[model samples]
Target: MGAWSRLKEAFTREANISSPEDLLAQARGMRNGKVPVTKDTALRNSAVWACLRLRADLMSSFPIDVYRYVNGIQIEVPKPPVLVSPGGTEVGMREWMYSTEFDLDRGGNCFGVITERSGVIGPDGRGLPGRIELVELGAVAIRGNGSTITKFIINGAEYDPWEVWHEKQYTVAGVPLGLSPVAYAAWVIEETLSAQQFARDWFAGGAVPLAELKNNAKVVNAKDARVARDQFRAAVDDSGLFVHGMDWEYKPIQAVASQSAFIEARQYGASEIARFFGCPGDLIDVAVSGSSITYASMTQRNLQFLIMNLGPAVGRREDAFSRRLVSGPRFVKFNTDALLRMDPEARARTIGARITNRTLAPSEARALDNLPPFTEDQLSEFDRLFGSRSVPAQPTTAVPGATP
Candidate 1:
């Protein structure tokens, strides 16, 4: 066909296409209307940093323990080789958890590779994994149907779903892919960045001072104007002084709004980011005013945070670790009590109450405090101090002396 004829035919074919595949193709070719926010841009906002860092630090620092079920009771067990030291590096369990949580919170997913080696068998004769290597989320890709991951592509190598450890949050469209909070809250982030940039430029340009050169005869040329502008800049550049030639007037430009306005805008953005992450604004140093709610102590606030905000994320991590790292009745859990650590006085009261109510033994309470169990002598001493007192005969004589 002739070139023009071929082009005409292409247009006709495109006009007639009406398949689902065609629609998908068109959608893929088009750009999304929303502002695009990458991980770097999202982290530029202080609020995003506070929200993500707070959660990552808390989640990672919380103590994690592996337990085995014996006779319907859970007993703490030694951490597996995989859990004690992951990624085949010096990264400990806490650091690994922090990185995983940070990746999930920022990018919506985290990936790791399980390494196996020969001649490294457990007592049961099963080969234990040599190491677990964390992979950057950007370097990993997923291929599967809507419901499950069929394969993972990591650093140019393909892996089976079972060979890769994956954790994700808030899947989209029945797929296990996670949706990043940065992508959803891009508009706010953009506004915050713009406001900050404006403030920075305002201060950087000598606070936007203006120069007015009065030519009485109105005969100044472009050269004169250029010269005047250069002279003004040179004087004010780091000197904070402006000198002009004859008939020139210098007037500082007043800002349309005060610096506090921009400050408030940035503060609002921080709160919004915290809200998006379901974190408390006050925890991130965002001021809260005119509020009736009050926490008598930090413990109460932390308890509220755990119960309302961080609890679900912790539970999700525990479930993921338990399923991926253990077999049968063995499980993994984060000891959330670590986050609720109390002052010595409060801890004493709590443990004392538990011991008094018989819900917790003295030895168990001591162990919880990282103290060694009591010996026989110490146990006898505790019994002497707290044991019940015997009733004396004076009580009988108090009954009106009738039974003397």
Candidate 2:
């Protein structure tokens, strides 16, 4: 057939046409539509398909688990909660939860909360209870001010920070506590996370690879560096429980760092809470002096808050938890023998002190460092290796395990 006839046939062919004319016309149409089907596009499409096919392999290259989000950024898997006592056998909840916040300054060290909450059974199943409302607890507001009531979703779980506060305001007893939608969403995600044997499983499904290349090199590079910087900065920034900065807020990658840093800080902070609040030196002294330990109720309440943050809602331990109340400074005790063995001078100061305040002085902070303990030299070495100018100190009123 002639070129024109072939072209016509290709354009209106009932059967699928394989003519070169058809290819040319198709190209023209694509061009008119502002689509560039260049070699780069082909190569990018091929690469993306290949990566999607071998995502598990690529993820396995890293030391930790990596998750790719809607935005083309990868975040690490959040740290799983560490269970107490039976250790790996029991699933202990995390002591503190971290989240992002909007800082008006929009620069270094943004505002966020390290929250503590407790679970109690009312008419319904075990639910979070008391002045321990989710709203009053420290968390970033998604839609309103810090004080405003709103819903927040973290890792797919939905929670209403307001509902908890409302219950508190009304003093509604046995309100049959329920997880907010955000919390419920998070609960689903958590269940999925738990069921998956490997982190790569999350991205294993039907994510279509893009055929056209959109060169997001700048955004991708910026995100990677920003995330790295946030993680590094959190290690350095000594402001709150989880050190975060707003200089480059929610840069996608930073979310990963923020989640991770917050989890770690809260985990480490739990022991400190146990030492400071669980068993304050003053309380110990009072009990030893043959006086009624009046702080017992306070201790139970504090422990209730701490345990709520870390304990499972229903289980073998549930009844034990409900039967006994939380109180005292939930401070994890240090072994004096171990301290003395580690540092004679630090030990001497620890032992020589006529009274232990449970309140840590700047110098004596090292005393309680016994549980997962670090010595002065170790802390110094950490600072040197990590290039940190300051050491983390707990708030005096925090009572170790209390959510600060």
Candidate 3:
């Protein structure tokens, strides 16, 4: 085959679909309230919600990977874009971007296009940021012959012009592996899970224990804090085979913007946390110049405490991503400023005390030293807060029936 022929194989959409009988069975199940109810359906519902409000917002569009975080974990799978009608017109498959932003003063153009996942959620509890969807009347694949195909996906299945040629073998340069959405999702999920597991293990003292901490006290300067975060994040990257952070930041804005507390924290703190934890990237400052930088938002007070406490131990947690989606920095600034707002004398006294004492109080030191190792229980709130005993109730969602 020529290069053009090879290109055709890799650049087309394909899927496994239910037959007429299968469709009828599914519809009947729906009517009977017995539709299998797999995680896939829940995910699809979540994805749909994320893409709903993209009618005309610009800047960052939703990517398909937005639906990756389901069930208290970051899922890294990709799904076909859910093309939809912006004006509710019946244009079958046309061209469209995921979001557009307009101001009477600024003029409206499409700003966000959902291409790949990056960790935002939809209103219905699905990750929506970094998601890309086909416009309601969108044409996805255009051939050199001036022909185009309409594409859409649901429940990890894709639909397109390729459906007519489903039986044809898909090959590229003598490689004959065909394309299918389920296969893609499976591969992506497996890879994502592996990386996540690796991150969890690496941070739990499995990588390199800071021997100095065992002998001396845990010393933390501003620079030391930065380095400690980086070292922990490095363990996460050592896996070398998994992907992360694609939709970690994008989903909540368009999909589930209601997470006010989480939204603030992520904008202020999570990014910093990600950086502090070892992102090896530029330090994202909470305050740049004078006013607080909006992007450096923070999570709720209690949640921030938990994340700061556990992050060095747990490589990554699903809650971090969700909270990050809606985070902003105002609340954190208030809390921080309030504490330091003490009178100059009190401030001097505090500073003098710290300068004089080389160590923390016994209780404070014990609290720091007794921090637990990473355990599935620690990840799940059902575990104890202090001791290794069991706790009541599984981790439930803030909203009932939210994608867990």
TM agreement with the true structure for every prediction: 0.77, 0.17, 0.17
lDDT of 3 at 378: 51
lDDT of 1 by residue, 107-132 (tens): 77788887763244433455545567
Q: Which stretches of candidate 2 lie over 4 Å from their true place?
A: 1-141, 145-147, 155-158, 162-342, 349-404
Q: After superposition, how far is residue 213 of candidate 2 from its true place, in Å?
A: 35
**Stronger candidate by lDDT (1 vs 3):** 1
Cα lDDT tens digits for candidate 2, 1-404: 44334334433422222212123335344331223332122112222223222222211221211122435533323322211211123211221111101110011011212133245333334332322212222232233222232444333344564332221111112211111211112222222232331223323422322122223333447677767556655754765343334443332222355346544543333323223222232322222334454534444533443344222211212232222212121111111121113245644565445225444443344334433334467678878988993555433331232100
Model 3 TM-score, 2 decimals: 0.17
Q: How would you encode candidate 3's per-residue C-alpha lDDT over 1-404 as one tens digit per residue?
A: 44344334433434332222122334333321322322133223222122222211211232212234467654333332332332234321123322221110011111123344335444445544443332311112222221123443333345543221111112224222222212222222233333344444545646434223211344457787566546545755896432334322211113133235333533443233223222211222333334442332233432343344323212221232233333221010001232113445654555446534833232232232343333455546544465544432322322211110
Off by over 4 Å in 3: 1-7, 11-153, 156-203, 209-404
Which scores higher on TM-score, 1 or 2? 1
> What lDDT score belongs to each candidate, Candidate 1 first?
0.69, 0.29, 0.30
Candidate ranking under TM-score, highest first, comes to 1, 2, 3
Candidate RMSDs in Å, in order, are 11.0, 29.3, 29.2
